[model samples]
Target: MNNASSSTPLGAARGIDPDLIAGIIIVLGAGALLTRTSDMPGMTALLPVTMLSALIVLGLLMIGRCLLRRRRRGDPEATAPAPLKVFDNARRFFGIVVAIAAYVAGVALLGFYTTTAVMIPVVAWCFGYRSLKGVLLADLIFTGGIAIIFVVLMGQELPTEFFLR
Candidate 1:
């Protein structure tokens, strides 16, 4: 049924709101995270659980806003949902999957820091980032930040496998 012809039991028309759809999706994802993390031991689960809970709250707010907007607009009936452009090309999506798989393999052989540094530029290039200087700078900054987080802040004992081993 179209927007104008359909109406809820209370006579309010059912209109599809993008905000409400996105909010529902986010809430589902956050709920999944919450479910997975709730069973984990120690403080490892604490951060993710807290973050997911906040995400759920934000999603609900989005949904509430969408409902409010629809109510204020005074919809005539049910509206069709907007199309979500997720994958324009199947090959491109498959290629990205391959790239991620290669990234995982590369990490085992080349180490986390090296693989990440290389992967960032390749992924950026694949996504149409043509500026060499900008890509390099971004790659450097991103890799450096990750290195600092893993090596300095977390104190993870990760060594360069390809160079050292």
Candidate 2:
């Protein structure tokens, strides 16, 4: 009898590989720590401090779970299958590039709020968010929050074009 259920599935479909996730988390944590430790001007220190602390804590927790699993199972051979190469990952990166390009191109013409507001939904849709309601919700949340932060709190001048004005 083929023990399909008993056999652990390989690859991305098998869900997140604990070891790989832990390794990534550890690397990210270390990088964040290094960045935080480095001398930077003004508020940059806050960015790294918050990011690094969160990353280190999360990484340690993940690593701890993996170690516990290893000890309990006692199966040194328990290995996750290799991940699949997906265009989605590449597409997401490309989407970010597209957003940046669009932002730069549209800054003077479309203005910050308009360009960013449009980009968020468009990018969300490109990244597999199908529902219009969900896209709108995300776009509103992101754009509104950014607007409040930069324009309201920080008092930064956003490009308010003819359309927005």
Candidate 3:
């Protein structure tokens, strides 16, 4: 076996684009959400359906971009496969997914604001952030934005914090 052939990235050799996979996954997720929201009352369903539709559109755009790039490069037919880096660390990827699941569960138990405030800093730290000030600032800004969007702008009631009750 040639050394160069052995060194080829798995995705490149397989003619698989990670972005294309991601786009298809996103579209499928959005489609699932759309189906789940279909039976909701008209006013309640409007926002979710609209957002899901937008998600689908964005996913389609990603897929289109990938296809265009492949066409331009004459992928599969081309002599050289473009090296692509997928997940650098599978552990970190799975860790983030677990963190997100925890975050979702925390939202129900601790309330949205409280859970989010804690999650932001913790996630930031896990991602190798060392600046305490930066993490705190990010936490504040994100929570504030959520508050402004859901409470002030949309006049939507968020999950009540236990202490605030």
Per-model TM values vs. the true structure: 0.56, 0.50, 0.78
- Top model by TM-score, which number? 3
For candidate 3, list the clashing residue pairs, or say none: none
Q: Could you give the candidate ranking by TM-score, starting with the highest?
A: 3, 1, 2
Between prediction 1 and prediction 2, which has the larger TM-score? 1
Superposed by TM-score, candidate 2 places the C-alpha of residue 96 at a distance from the truth, in angstroms, of 9.4
Q: Give the winner by TM-score: 1 or 3.
A: 3
lDDT of 1 at 32: 83
Off by over 4 Å in 2: 1-18, 29-37, 42-44, 75-119, 154-165
Candidate 3 residues 1-104, lDDT tens each? 68677565433555777788889999999999899997877766777899999999999999998887667555555554565566768899899899999988
lDDT of 3 at 72: 52
lDDT of 1 by residue, 1-165 (tens): 674444442333244556787799999989987999857764556557878999999999998987776675555464534432445687897989899999989989998789888998898899899999999999899888877865687565555768878
Clashing pairs in 1: 3-78, 14-78
lDDT of 2 by residue, 10-110 (tens): 32334444464656768685775666566765554554566677777777777676656545444446654444343437766686877788878887788
Cα TM-score of candidate 1: 0.56
Q: Tell how far residue 3 is off in model 2, in angstroms.
A: 13
lDDT (CA) per prediction: 0.76, 0.67, 0.84
